[model samples]
Target chain A: MSKLNIKNLIKSFPSMDRPAVNNVNLDIESGELVAFLGPSGCGKTTILKMITGLFQPDSGDIILDEQSLLKIPTEKRGVVMVFQNYLLFPYMNVNENVGFALKMKGVDKNIIDQKVKEMLELVKLPDIGLRKPKQLSGGQQQRVALARALISNPRILLLDEPLSNLDAHLRDEMRDLIVTIQQKLKVTTIFVTHDQEEAVLLADKIALIFDGELQNFTSPKNYYEKPKNIKAAKFFGGVNFINAKKHNDNLSTNIGTIHYKGENYTDLNEDNIITIRPENIKLSKNNDFNNNSFKGLIKSVIFSGTHTRYKIIVNDLELECSLQSVGLQDIKTDDTIYVHLPSDKIWAMNE
Target chain B: MGGERLKIILSLTPPLLIIFTLFFGGIFYGFLQSLGYQPAIGKYEINFSAYYNVMFSERYAKLFWTGLGLNLWVSFASTFLAAVFALFGALAIRKTFFAKTICNFIYSLNLPMPHLVVAVGIIFVFSQSGLLARFASQIGLIGSPGDFPVLVKDKYGLGIILAYIWKEAAFFFIILMSVLQSLGENFEELAQSLGANRWQRFRYVILPLVMPNLFSASIIVFAFSFGAYEVPALLGVIYPQMLPVMAFEFFLNPDLNARSEGMALSIIIAIIVMILVVFYFWLTQAKIRKD
Candidate 1:
C-alpha cells in the first residue's frame, strides 16, 4: 500500500451546508515531500486535519502503510501536523514538550532523554530544553516545534503554512531548516501553503487547487510550465495574454500565427484565447519589423531593482513585460517602441 | 507670574474640583472617623482609644482570620479551576466534536444571571430530597430524604465548590475561547507535529499562547470569588460562614456599635482580597519573566 492514500475526503463546518473539503483524493509516496498549493480558504488545512485524524472525513478511505487509517485516533495516526502558528505548550520546557509523546507511550526516561536530545539536535536546538516556548523567538519556536513533532518519529509530517508567520528572512531560514530536517528523516510530508513560490521551492510534487477543486496534480516544473487551467497559469508570476483568433491549420494571434503545442480540444474553433509569457516578449528599437512585431508607446516604466517592468500600449492591445535591467535603454513613458512576440512562445488556448 | 502652565491648570479646574470635593472628601472623612473623632456620629472627642481597643480585640482576629481563609480558599479554588476548565473547554471545542456544539451553547448562555440562580440549581441537584435522592430511593438505597446522602450545604463545602465551578468556569471559558481562537489553530497544530500529545500540546503550545488571557481571567475570577456573597450564602455551609456572609451579618446586627465593627470586618475582607490580588499579579509577573 502507499505510505498515505486519501480517497474522497470531505469535511464541512456547521454554518454552511456544503463541505469545505469536497471529494478530495491524494496518494503520497513513502518519503515524498508533497505540497498542497492553493489560495486561502481552499480547504488545504481541512485536508491536513483529515489526514491527521483531527477532523474525521465525512466520507473517505485513508490507507496508511497498507492499513486503513479511518478508525485511527490522532495519537495513533503516526502523522505529525506542524501548524502555521507553531503551537507549543506554555507550561513545559522545550525538552519536556519534545519528550511528551514518549512519556505517553511509556518509554523509559533515559531513552526519552536520548531521543529528545537527538531530535533537538536534528532541529539544531541543542541544550535549550529547559527554555519555554515564550522564551524562544519566532524561528526558534518554529524549530522547537519541529523538534517536538519529529521527536515522535512519525511516518508522515503535515505542515500548514508553518513559515507564514516569520519575517521574510526568517521565513526563508525556517523553510530551509524544515527541508533539511525532512531530508534527514525521510518522512513523507504534506506541506500546505498559498505561496506558489514556496510550493515550487520545497515540494517534490505540487497539487494546485482552486476554489476547493483539484485543478491539477503534477510536478512543479510541469505545473508552472504547462498549467492545466487559467487559474494555475496565473498562479505563476510571468503569464500575460493578448488578443487572438484561430483559423484553419495554424492559430492567428496578435503576436503571429502560432501552432498549438497543447492537446487539440474538441471545443476549440476559430475564436480562441491566446496566452503568452511576459519574459518571452522581446523589445527592440526597430519599427521596420513586420509580421510578429507591433509598434507601441511605453505607457509606464517601473524600476523594480533587479528587472524593470514596462506597460506598453500598441493600438488596442496593452501588455505588461519585464526586462533585465542590464544594458537596456531607459525608455521614457509614452516613447514609441517595437515589441516582438515569437509565434512558438505564445500558446493559443481554447476555452 | 506663570511658567506657561497656568492655562493647563485652568483647563483642569472643572473636573478636578468635582473629583477633589467628592474623592478626597470621602478619604478625609474616613481618616477622621478611624481616628475616633467623627463629628457626624457625635463622637467629636479626638481619642485613640476606639482604634486602640479594636486593634487588640480577639473578635477582630476572628474576623481577620475568617476573611483571610475564605478569601484564600474561594479565590484560589475558583481561579485555579476556572483557568483549568477554560483551557480544556477551549481546546475541546477548537475542533468539531459530537457534544461540542451543545457544550459551547451552554458555555455561552447568559453569564450575568446572578450567582444565586446557579446556587439554586446546585441545591436542586445536590441537596438531600432532591433529584439525586429520588434516584437513590428508586434504586433501593434509601427510603427518604433523611437517609439520602448529604452534599449541598454540607460542612465539607462541596456545594460552594460546585456552584463556583459551574458559574466561574463558564465565565473564564468565554474570555479564554476568544484568546485561544484568536491565537489561531496554527500554533497548536505545530505543537502536535512536534510529537506532543493532547496533554503536551496544551502544556507547550496552548498554555503559552493563552497565558496572558488566562492570567487576566483568573484575576477577575479571584476578585469575584473573594467578594462573593450570593452563591456561598445560599449554598455554602453555616459553621464558619464565608467572609462576605460574616461581613453582611455584622452589618445587619441591631446594635449601633456593631455597625462599626461590621465595617471593620468588611475592611478586613477588602484588605485580604487586595493582598490576594497583589499576590496573583506577582506570581504571574514572575512566571512571565521566567519564561
Candidate 2:
C-alpha cells in the first residue's frame, strides 16, 4: 500500500496572511526515506507535525494506507516523531524512555524489557539502559530518542531535524545512525533537516521547500543534478548561475560562448539559466576534450585540505570553482588559466 | 575573579539579602522573644517551668492543640482544593483571549483586596443575615437568619475555609498558570500524539511537568492559611479563636504568666512551621527523584 497520501493540506496560525502548509500534496511509499529540506520557518516541520497527527489541518485530507487519518486521534495514528532537540524526557532513563511507547500501548513488562533490549542493541547503546538523558551525550540521547520511537514498530517515523543540536563530529555520526536504523526498520521514514549535506547523505528522496512552498521533491541525486528552478539551484552548493542566451547552435554566457552538448539545442530560449556546481569546473592544462572552457585570471583561491576553491572573476561574473589538488596545475592569483565547465555539468534550469 | 562572576554576585545579592533580613530575621526574633527570658519581661533566667506550664496548662493546652488540629485541617483541605481548582483554571485558559482575560482577572483580583476586608466580605456573604441566608429566605428554604445553623462564629471553622479558598485559589491560579504556560505547548501535543487522552496527558505529562511549581505553591498556600488571623477572627472570633487569635489573647492578657505562655505558644507555632518546611523539602526531593 502507498504509506501516505496528503491531498491539498492547508494549515494557518491566526493573524497570518496565508496558510503555513498551503495546499501541500504528496505521496510517500512504504520503506522509503524522504527528507524535507528547507530553510528555517519554512513549515517543513508543520507538515511533519500534521502527518504525525500533532496538527489537524484546517482543510483537506490525509490518507495513510487507504485509511482516512482525519478521524483517528494522534496516539492511534501509528506515527512516532523524534524532535530536533532529541527531547528525551529528562525524568526517564534510557530504558524507561525507550519503552514509553510500549508502556502507553500497555505491553507486558517482560516483553517490553526484551524489545527495549533489542532496540537498544540496534541503536548500539545496549549498555545505557539505566542512564538518564542528561547523563548521556547528545548522540546517545539521539539514539535513545530513535529507540523510543522504534519500540512501538510504528507504521511511519517522522523526524524533525533530529540531529540539529549535535556538534560537527556528532552530527556526522548521528546522520549515519539515522540512515542505518531507518533501513533496518524498513518503515516509511521522513527525515527533516535544513543542512543540504545531511539531507543528501541520508535521504533516499528529498523534498526541497521554500517559504512554506514545495520547490521540488525528488531523489537527492536528481535534485542536485536537475534543479527545477533558480531557487532550488541556489539552495544547493551550485553557485555559478550564468544567464544564457541561445545563439544558433550555441548559448552565450558571462564566461563567454558555450556549445550545447545535449540534444534538441535548436529549441532557442532567452530565459534559460545555466547552473554549475562549484566543484564541477575543472582547472588543468591536459586539454581533456573539445568542450567549452573559460580562460580567465584566477582572482582568489581558498585551499581546503582535499580541494582548492577558486573565485575566478571573468567578465564581471565571479564563478566559484572547486578543484582537487590532484588536478592541480600550479595555478595562482593573476594566472591565466582555462576552467573547463563540462556541458554535462552545466545545468540549465527553467525558472 | 572573573568579570562575569562579579556581575552575577552583584545581581543576586539584593534578593538574598532581602530574604535573609525579612523572613529569617523576623522568625529568629520571634523565637527568641517566645522563650520567656526577654529582659523586657523582667525575667533574667531561662525558665523551663514557664515552658512546661505553657505546654501543660488545661485551658491553654486545650486551646493550643484544638487550634493546631483545626489549623492543620484547614491548611490541607484548602491546599488540595486550591491545587485542583487552579489546575482547571490554568488549563482552561489556553492562548484564547477570553480565557486569558478571565484568568488574569481571577489571579490578580486579590492583589488590591485586603485579606481582612475579604474575611468581612466572606462573613457578610455566607453568614446568617448574609446574602446566602437572604437568598435562601427569598427562595423559601429558611424562615429566618437565626435558623440558618450559624456557619459564622459556629466554631467549626467552615467559614474560615471558604474565605481561605476564595483568596488562596486565586493566588495558586496565578502561580500555576505561569508554570503551565512556561512548560510549553509541545509536550502535551507530543504526549497526545503518542496516544494519551487529555486525562492521561495531564496525569503523566502535565502534572509531572508542573509538579515542582504545584508543590511549592501548595506549601506557600498552606503556610499562609495556617498562620492567618484576620479571616478566622472575622468569621469565628468570639466562639473559639484560632491559634493566632488565641496567641493574641495571651499576648494581650492582664497576667504576666499568660503573656509568657503566649511567647511559648509562639515557639510551638515556630516548631510546627519548621516541621512543615522540612516535610515540604523532603517531599520535593522525593518528587524530583521520581521524575
Candidate 3:
C-alpha cells in the first residue's frame, strides 16, 4: 500500500495566470525515496508545500496512510520539511534545535537529551551541540537541519533543494550522507530539486515536472531511456532529436531508416520524433553497425576533461555525440565519422 | 590609507564639533549648575547642596519621590503596553498585502505627529467633560459630565500613559513591521513543520527572533517617555506629577537658587534613564548569550 497519495492537486496564485501546481498526482510507497525534479518556478516545491499543509490545494486530496490529510493541521500532520537555507532556529543552540520537536511534545528531558545525542552522532557532528547555528559552516548547518528534522521521526520527510546551497565537494558529501541516513531510517522521503544529477543519484523514483504539470514519474533510467515526451527527454539532456515517421517496425528520419525494437506506436500522434542520448550515439572511423548507421561530418569538437562532445552533421541534420576521450584517436573539427544509433537506445516520442 | 583617514575625519568634523559644542557642552554646563555653581547669583562655589535640596530636603522630598514613582510607572507601563499592542498589530497585518499596506500607513500616521498634539487629543477624548463623557451621558451610561471618571489629569497618570502609548506604539509598530517583514515567514513555517503549533511557533520562533530589535526599540521608547516633559505637563495631575513635569516646575521658581535644584533634578532624570538602559542591555544580553 502506498504511504502517501497526492490526487489531482492544484494551486493557483491570484497574481499568476496559470496554477502554480496543476493536477499533480503521485503515489509514494512506504520507505520509498522520491524526488520532485524540475527547473525553477516549476511548482515542484508547491506540491511539497501542499503535502505538508503549508499550502492548501484548490481541488484535490492528499491521503496519507488511508486518511485524508486536508483536515489535519500542519503541526499535527507529522510531516517535516528541511528548507534549502537551513532555517535552524537562530536563537537556539545545536542541541536545543535538534530536540525542539520532542520538546514541543513534552517529551522527557532525558530521552530528548539521549535522542539529540544520537541524532548529532548520526549527522556526524557530535561535539558541536553547544555551538550556535551561525557558528557552523553551511554544510554543517544543513546537516544539523537534517538531524533536527529526522529526530522527530516524521511520517513523511520533505527536503527542498537541501544540497543546492553547498559547494561541489560538500554537495557530494551531503548527498552521500542523505542516502545513508535515509536508508538506515527507512523513512518515506521526498525532496525537490532542479539538478538532474542530484535527483538521479538520490531518488528511487523521479517525478519530472514542467510548467506545473507532471511530465513523467518513473525510475531515473526510464527518464534517460524512455522519457514520456520531448520535454522530458530534453530536460534529461537529450540533445539529438530527429523528426521521424514510424512505419510497421521502424522509424524513417532525415538521417536514415532507424530500426528500433520497441513498443508499437500505432496510437501515438503523427508528429513523432526519435531521440537518442549523446553518449549512446556511437562514433567510429568506419561503419560498424548494420542498421541505423550514417556518415557524418564533425562540425565541432569540445574536449571536456572526461569526454569529448562532437556536433556532427549527417544528411543535413545536426546530431550530437559524446565519446570517452581516454583511448580515442585524434578527432578534431571537420573530421568525417560514422555515427550509429543503437536500436535499443532509440526512444520515440510525440513532438 | 592615511589620506583616506584624513578625509573621513575632515568630513566628520562639522557634525562632531556641533554635537560636542552644542549637546555635550550644554550637559556640562547643566552639571555645573546642578552642583550649585551659579555665577549669575554670585555663588561661584561648587557644592552638592542643590542635589541634597532636591532629593533629601523636607520641602521637596515627598514631591521628588512621588514624581520619580510616577515617572517609572508611566514609562514602564507605556513602553510595555505599546510594545505588546504593536507586536500583535504587526503580526496581524504582516500577511495580508492590501490590508497590511493600509494598516501600515494608518499605524505609521502617528509616528511623525507631535506628542503634545496626541496629549491634547487624549484630553479631548478621555477627559471628564470630553467627547466620550458627553456621549456616554447622552446615551445614559452616565448621569452627566461630572459622572464621568476622571481619566486625564488623574493621580494614576493614566492620561499621560495613554498619550505615550498612542504616540510610541506607532514607533514600535514601524520598527516591528520592518523587522517582521525582513524576517519573512520562513522561521515560523520551519517551526510549524517541526510540529510546533501557532502559540508554540510564536513563543519559540517569532518572539525570540524579534526580541533583540524589540528590546532596542523599547529602550528608546522607555528613555523618551521617562525624560519627556510635554505630555506629562499637559496631562498630569498637580500633586503627584511625573519627574519631568516636576523638574520643569522648579525652573519656574523666581529664586535664582532654585535653578540649580531644577538642573539637579534634570541630571538625576538623565542618570536614572542611563542606568535603566544599561541594566536592560545587561539582562537581555545575558539571555542572548545563553541562547
DockQ of 3: 0.76
lDDT of 2 by residue, B130-163 (tens): 9998888888899977667677766778888877
- Give the chain A TM-score for each candidate: 0.89, 0.90, 0.96
Q: Where does the lowest 10-residue lDDT sum fall in candidate 1 chain B?
A: B47-56
Residue-wise C-alpha lDDT for candidate 2, range A225-329, written one tens digit per residue: 777788888888668888888776678876678876654354436768787888888776455656787666789978898988898877778888988867577
Question: CA shift at A15, candidate 2, in angstroms?
Answer: 4.0
Model 1 lDDT per residue over B133-244, tens place: 8888888788876687677877556678777888887888888887866777765555454445777666656676787777777777777787778887897666656777
Q: Which residue pairs show collisions in model 2?
A: A75-B195
Residue range A1-351, candidate 1, lDDT tens digits: 128888877777787666788787888898899999999888888888888877787787888988887787777777888777776766788988788778767799999999999988888889788987888999998888787777778888888888898999998888898788778778899899999989999989998776666777889987655566567778877456655565656667664565555555345566767666777778887765554677888989899888888889867678888899898986889888998766656655554
Best by DockQ: 3
As for candidate 3, its clashing pairs are none
TM-score of each: 0.73, 0.87, 0.96
Residues A153-269 of candidate 3: C-alpha lDDT, one tens digit per residue: 999999999999999999999999999999999989999999999999999999999889999999999999998888999998999888988765678877778897767477556
User: Candidate 1, A106: how far from true, in Å?
Assistant: 4.4
Cα lDDT tens digits, model 3, B138-247, are 99999998899989999999999899999999999999999999999988888898999999988999999899999999999999999999999999989898888888
What TM-score results for chain B when candidate 3 is compared with the true chain B?
A: 0.93
